[model samples]
Target: MNLRLYSYWRSSSAWRVRIALGLKELEYRYAAVNLLEGEQWSEAQRARNPTHQVPVLEVERAGQPPLRLVQSMAIIEWLDEVHPSPPLLPATADGRARVRALAEHVNSGIQPLQNAIVLKRLREKVPGWDRAWAQQAIAEGLGALERAVADGGAGRFCHGDSPGLADCYLVPQLYNARRFGLETSGFPTLLRIEAACAALTAFQAAHPDRQPDAPSSDPATSPATSPAAAPAAAGRSP
Candidate 1:
């Protein structure tokens, strides 16, 4: 089978897909799509996903029909199914439900709130929307995650001692949290879980800054994912 990933360096959703792929040891051709430059809105990308979202996975097998999967959560779950080793979901049915609950908490409730598109729309509708608002939204959303992780579950991971789907979802959102200058010190427990996740090679490799399309310099200094500062090989699909 051949896998193709359409991704942007700093897109949190794309970051989630990459983490799942790395944890499964899945080999895929990385196709860099600069979302900020309206590349994701291009006809070619729109053909793949009408929503024009990054992290679209194309599953191609020689004799079978190619399937396209969109949305990070869906793609991650599919990755677990395609490559069972180092499974993303927990083993037991109850455990799987619990993990999915935590994942859904972030995936559905927290993540979509601060996504690039949502933020853009928010800026238009709410004239006061700014970095401060982003900082507050992230704090509230992730503060809830902190309470859930602390009171509910997560061992070395969200469900148990091994890294699973929850970690994959949460870490990238934290990357986005950092971008907004969210104060994570208030949520010590969540930060602790994130610290552990950051140590894992899967999470580390999945980081946006580590992606081929990421800037060589520090992102905190130059924040735009703008195509102007794009690297020479930025548009190529590998």
Candidate 2:
């Protein structure tokens, strides 16, 4: 299979898909979509995804038509289904439900509110509303995620000892939380899982700074170098 990922360096949605690809040990070409430069609004991108979002995965197989997958969660789930060695989901139905709930807490409940387009509109219509709104939305969403993980039988990760689907979503959302200046010190369980994730090669390779389109010299804003980049823990799955 020939895989190409349309991604933006700072996109949390794209970050999730990158982590899934790394964990699955899949090799893919990186097609950088510069969201900062309005590349996603171009006619080409609109044809790729009507939503005009980053993280569109293009799959090509011999003698078959190419498949264009949109939305981070859908793309990640498809990858998991096709490449199941290091399963992104749990084996049991109940466990799968729990992980999906946790993932959705970030994907559906949190991310859309602070999306770039949403924030841009907020900035234009209600001056000074973008940052404050993003901070509040992320704070509230993260607080709920922290409580859920604490009460949801979490082990080394959001669902179990191994990093799975929820971890993929959680790590990137936490990066956005920090980027928005939200104090993450209150979420111990989430932070612990994040630390565990940071140690893995998959997460490290998937970080925004490691992407080809990332700004070359912005160490202060780079999550890979930020204070939140915790020390690696032992026994983390690859």
Candidate 3:
């Protein structure tokens, strides 16, 4: 199979897919989508994803039309099933459900509210929109995540000793939370799992600052300036 990933350098959703690809050891061409500059809304990109979001995975096989996948979670799950070694989901049904639930706590609950477009909208529509609103949303979601991990679902990495789906979701959200200045001092188990995941080369390589599209000098200093500067935010998946 041939694979190509359309991603933004700093997008957490795209970062999640990148981590999954790294863990699965899948090689793919990187197509940088500059979200901050509104490149995602371009006609060509819109053709790839109607929702105009980053992290579209184009899959090609020997005798089939190119499969265009939109959501980050769906793309990662497909990769886990097709690749199979070092499985991302657990073996048992209960285990898979738990992992999926943990992942969704971030994917569905936290990520949607913290997306760039949503925040942008809130800023324009709401009265005196502040970064505090985003921070509060992040804090609430992360609090739940902390409890989930502390309650029973965490090990060295969110499920068991090895990093899996939940770790994929956890690491990126933590990255974004830090970007938003959400204090994470309360979530020790989440922090511990994040630290464990960070030790892995896959997670390190998939980091927002490590992407080719990110500015070589400083990723945070520049944004909404160039494609290189376009990465410093969270994303929505079409």
* Shift in Å, residue 11, candidate 3: 0.5
Candidate 2: tens digits of C-alpha lDDT, residues 1-238:
8777788888999999989988887877677788888888888889889998988888889999989999888998999999888999999999999999999999999999999889999999999999999999999999999999999579999988999999999999999999999999999999999999999988987888876568773533222221111222111122
Candidate topping TM-score = 2
Candidate 1 lDDT, 21-107, residue by residue in tens:
878876666677888778987888888899988889877899999899999889988889878988889789988888887788878
lDDT of 3 by residue, 87-190 (tens): 99989999899999999999999999989988888889885574778899999999999888776766798998888998999999998898998889899999
In TM-score terms, candidate 1 sits at: 0.87
Model 3 clash pairs are none
Model 3 scores a TM of 0.89
lDDT of each: 0.76, 0.84, 0.82
Off by over 4 Å in 3: 217-238
Alpha-carbon TM-score of each model against the true structure: 0.87, 0.90, 0.89
Q: Which is better, 1 or 3, measured by TM-score? A: 3
**Which residue pairs overlap in candidate 2's backbone?**
none
In terms of lDDT, the best-performing candidate is 2
Model 2 ranges off by over 4 Å: 217-238
